[model samples]
Target: MIKFFRKIRQNLLSEGKTAKYFKYAMGEIILVVIGILIALQINNWNEEKKYQKQLHIKVHSILGDIREDALQIKALLKDLEKQHSAADHIIPIMESEQKAIVDSLKFILDFNSFTTTPILSQQNNTWDYLSANGILSELEDQELVNLLMNYYNYFDELTINFNNSANPVRLELRELKYELFTNTEHRKFFPTKKPSVPSKAVYESIFNDIRILPLCRYIGSTAAYFEGRFKDVDQKAEKIIYYLETNYQPI
Candidate 1:
């Protein structure tokens, strides 16, 4: 192409048409400018396409993380619900019925000691890049960023509250363990002494009377709170999915 343009310019100059040569020379300069402009446009288009591809991959990854966290939260909710049910059964029995039933309540109190598995921590690396690197600024609107921020904040709050509520149950369980093992009951049930009904159930009733029923109800409340938060997390995940489907594409 360069050779062709050079040949045309040489022929026009050889013809001694100075005015015509000036016009042709100007035309050639215009064509070269146009060509440069087209090349620059193509380069910008390719850069934009590459960025969109990366954005799609990041959005898909975030969607997958949301789905996995939703399932995990649901499973944990069910386990806590089961623990709550068992405690409910033993609490009423200890409250109004036989004092010997307190041994069963002690077993129920042990349920309170079962720690809740913590929820997944916040993962915002993709979000940070898109926002901090000005990728999000390049987005046509703010809707996508707003939606993600809302869901992220929701799960972060859920994890904090869930752990806070579970703390009392742990304290109750620790105290119960101390009462049971620090007395004659430990020796009677373990390596040396023979076990008897009084050592196993009757005397243990004192500790049970002091602690069991109240602690079980407190544990139930904590478990129920966790179940409610699990539902909230699920709702937030659904919201995120809805936004992704409406405004973003998968890679």
Candidate 2:
């Protein structure tokens, strides 16, 4: 191409068409500049397409992870609700009441179920990775970002509360239960196999333990708090899922 243009220039110079040569030279320069701009434009377009495809993959992966997160949060909510109910059932039975063997076994079972553990929070592994990589900014929706931030922030707070506020109370109650009722006694009612009928003595021990009432209240309140947290997360997750479903196409 350069040789062809040089040949044209030489021919114009030989003919002494100086004005025509200048015009032809200017036109060639313009054509080269325009060709360069078109090439640049095509390059930019291809880069945009590549970035868009990458963004789509990340978004779809996040959606899948968030979907599992929704399921986990829902399951946690149900479990917390159940624990709260068990605490409710155990709260009313005090040392003053003379309960039957059936009632005693039920109370012991409920008590064990309620105070034995703390509620674990939902996981956000995909969001964590994306945030670390500065990829969350690629998300177009500000509301979705805000909701995700709020959800994880609340989850961190909930985890701290569970570990600090609830687990200590649970441990305290567990210690008291073991102090009053031996592991053999716990196994009698809460056997890995079919539970044996608990004696009235076991019921009396649980009822008479002064720590039991306060422990029940603690368990119920903590479970209620987690339930509320999960409910808020549920709303956030539902909104996010709705937005992604409407606006995002998974790869």
State each model's CA lDDT, in order: 0.66, 0.76
RMSD of each: 5.3, 2.7
Segments in model 2 whose C-alpha atoms lie over 4 Å from true places: 1-4, 95-102, 118-122, 191-193
TM-scores of the candidates are 0.73, 0.85
Q: How far is 10's C-alpha from truth in model 2 (Å)?
A: 2.6
Candidate 1: worst-modelled 10 consecutive residues by lDDT: 189-198
lDDT of 2 by residue, 100-156 (tens): 334655666777776556455455677788899998887777887887788778767
- Candidate 2 vs. true structure, TM-score: 0.85
TM-score quality measure for candidate 1? 0.73
Which candidate number has the best TM-score?
2
Q: Report the C-alpha displacement of residue 70, candidate 2, in angstroms.
A: 2.1
- For candidate 1, the per-residue lDDT at 23 reads 94
lDDT of 2 at 19: 99
How many clashes in each candidate?
0, 0
Please identify model 1 stretches exceeding 4 Å from their true place: 97-125, 128-134, 139-144, 171-175, 178-214, 242-250
